[model samples]
Target: MLNRFLLPALAATLLTTACTEPPKTVAALPILGERDVRPRADGGPADTVYAAVPAFRLTDQAGQPVSNQTFAGRAYVTDFFFATCPGICPKMQSELLKVYKKFPTDPRISFLSITIDPDHDSTAVLRDYAQRLGIGDASRWHFASLGDRAKSFELANHLLTGVVPDSLAPGGLAHNGTLALVDDRGYIRGAYDGLNAGQVAALQRDIPVLLAEIDGRKKGVAKK
Candidate 1:
């Protein structure tokens, strides 16, 4: 319901039930076709194109340096999370963990769990958090430090895709469980709400296709 990017829920339900196949069950994503999950940015005639990522440096869960440069030449699944959240964070994380395990042996893909509450979700806190979630592997999956509240908030607005931090008062910032797909060139290819198992599975299926596309293109160029 949060993401009406597809269609009205009633229509979606009707369409999904009318067709047995997952591809035909749902409508076309803003960017991906019924069967294709790889972002169609450069492919032309795809759903949409992504904007280039900006340059910025931050820390990792291990307190190491990380930047937009960090994601360059790599593909990954990214999401925003906080150490202390009650509403959808738990369920959302549960779903994301399913995705983390999906590509257990995938060397070409990585996972980026960016914490919105950087102040509370420090390196040690994030490390503990990952352990609690039973994340697959540290090397394959990572949690990034989003700097301070000011920078994190700004980045979310600029990127127009992540987080809504809260005030220290009564309630917290409104959070969404969307997982973003970033390409090897540091461009955002697509996004999905990780709270939905069906959507997550769809995303899992698409990642390999995107990787294969890039790899194939590289090979073709090398031959030329």
Candidate 2:
């Protein structure tokens, strides 16, 4: 009869609808680097801890000592730039400002702009630069110095982003034009080209995803 045929078709449509629903958002961001690996006691395979930015101490624009601990429970965007750069640094900052404006006053997020030219960008210089940029909130944004030239280069080239001294370069130093997104746990979640509007927008999108992932984990633990 028509009732029997219609019932089966309705069931089929319902099944199809159930199957087509989008899956839940899962945070599966790949951990960068393979060095933080260890062998399992059961001898199955080595486990990777996922590379994390090592602890560092630096002086912020306010002449205050800040370290990795400063961002212990906050997600942050980081980039390397000197105050007087005549090239892409300005563009990078302009893009980063968009991200900042999007999350302004959100204590869960912060920004770090570390200077590669620390010798010339002293605390006073950084403070002045920050002021000019309208960065009135020191807690949310920091312009810092690594203090040591070799350490600065090491951090720029190895830890956060790429940087190299070049006499022929526009700013006396060549550096990556990307911004690094670090999760609350100190792991680098993602990197976006700070000079590209599209990539910067992607960075903004990923920030909430990372924050949601952290929130989900916390709720899971609480339910246990």
The most accurate candidate by lDDT is: 2
Pull out the clashing pairs in model 2. none
Which regions in candidate 1 have their CA more than 4 angstroms from the true location?
1-50, 158-162, 165-171
Candidate 1 C-alpha lDDT tens digits along 37-154? 3557586665544455567676776677777666666677777777887777788788878877878768778887777777788888888888888763566678777768767766
Q: What lDDT would candidate 2 get against the real structure?
A: 0.85
Prediction 1 TM-score vs. true: 0.71
lDDT by residue for model 2 (123-196), tens: 99999999999899777899999899879877765455778889999978888886988887888888888988
TM-scores of the candidates are 0.71, 0.88
Q: In terms of TM-score, how similar is model 2 to the real structure?
A: 0.88
Model 1 clashes, total count: 0
Q: Distance from true position, residue 96, model 2, in Å?
A: 0.3
Residue-pair clashes per candidate, as listed?
0, 0
